[model samples]
Target: MVANFETVTSGVNLNQYAGRLEQLGPALDGIGAYAERQVKLAIAQGRKLSGERLAPLSPNTVAEKRRSRKARGILRRDGGLLASIQFQRTRANEVQVGSNLKYAPWVILGTRPYKIRPKRKPTLRFYTADGWRSATEINHPGLPERNIFEGAEKAIGPFATATIAAHLEGDL
Candidate 1:
């Protein structure tokens, strides 16, 4: 079933492609860390991976930010969430980049109007534009979808692909 190579002037070594595929091992190993970095960079730049500017913080949130000196920068309160953004190797060739914070979902995916009430207490006390107030329940307007996790796919997708391609081609 094979053609005669004796008549051919140039040599054909199809095995080269198989060897190139070996480069994927290293590329896969580093992809997780690379993706985490891109996500953090996008946050610092205050932009989405698609080059769109991130939505501004809510007005009440902004006021809260101003009130607390510990809150520095957008979505950075005490730097906990930002520092929590990391890469975890779930499998030999698989990795996940995200935060373990409970509110990460709320940050990426906007919530609908909901009621917030005291769980351990008889009532709730919070400050408002008018001043401090006491209530049994409060209606939260909810937040907008930041879609920060979208950074991983949009920013790292092509970069990782190109890196693996370059490595496979021996051009990395």
Candidate 2:
């Protein structure tokens, strides 16, 4: 009696898995949009919570005269910076989100002592509750740092995990 033994090897095909990975661009785009919206919402909420007005005007104490038209506020009056906030796919698997405004970092982190100068005249004149006053140099106390981005960043991990899970489960 003769006995023979044979060994066989099997290979797994990963083309389907590769195809699924290649098709993740749209899903990643969706996640990026979600993150951008979430961050924007957080910033808006922070603005509301901080009681920051869209345009704040200086007080006028004069009995018959109109108050000086001075605008104040972190939010843009023209909606340019707010509208410029956006997210874009920087790479095949990467996304970048931020505002295009030059003053965005200053608004977020605030500034130190700065000088305030008159726009037109040499002397800075303003009408306060006390009375009208003129100042050669005004020291401006910078705005307090608002943690809008920090708040949004805290939610990113959960948002990404849930979104990816849903996508993989066909629930997204």
Candidate 3:
């Protein structure tokens, strides 16, 4: 038998896998949206993506929130942080979910103990168990680590498998 075959260097087909591979980009897009929704949902419920309940708000915090007309939920105030959650698609299979809000890190890792004083006013006025009080300066205990966003990021690991499988199957 005599045969002639031209050397091929491109347009290689991945056979049956090509179709699924093509679906990956769209899959990642969906995954990012899905992940963002999951994180926001977890936060709205005042829990971590791991289903861990967030730390309870201090009495002072609750009282102040009520008086200031802010949402009285843990890790929630005026809904800015929740609305700021975002996801960026960086590659065919990679997406990054994060926030541009400056205080997001503080929500994730908390803060060190510090003094809180009025910058413009002579004293700080806030509510407490004993009712309204005024102070020139107050020692604030460091906030407890919420880590809700981090927990959601971690939980997405398991979700990635399911999401990809669903995407490939056109079920996502």
Candidate with maximal lDDT:
3
Report the C-alpha lDDT of model 1 over 1-172, residue by residue, as the tens digit: 0001011114555477567654455666567667777777776776666767777876666666666655645666777667778876554445677788888777767789899999999999876545568999999988777776654555667766676657667875
Residue 161's lDDT within candidate 2 is 57
Residue runs of model 2 more than 4 Å from their true location after superposition: 1-17, 47-78, 126-133, 168-172
Clashes per model (N, Cα, C within 3 A): 0, 0, 0
* Candidate 2, 51-89: lDDT as tens digits: 342223223322113444322334434455556667776
Superposition TM-score, candidate 3 onto the true structure: 0.79
Task: Give the lowest summed-lDDT range of ten residues in model 2.
Answer: 1-10
| Residue 97 in model 3: lDDT | 75
> Which is superior by TM-score, 1 or 2?
1
lDDT, model 1, position 109: 72
- Per-model TM-score, in order, reads 0.76, 0.63, 0.79
RMSD of each: 10.0, 14.6, 11.0
Best by TM-score: 3
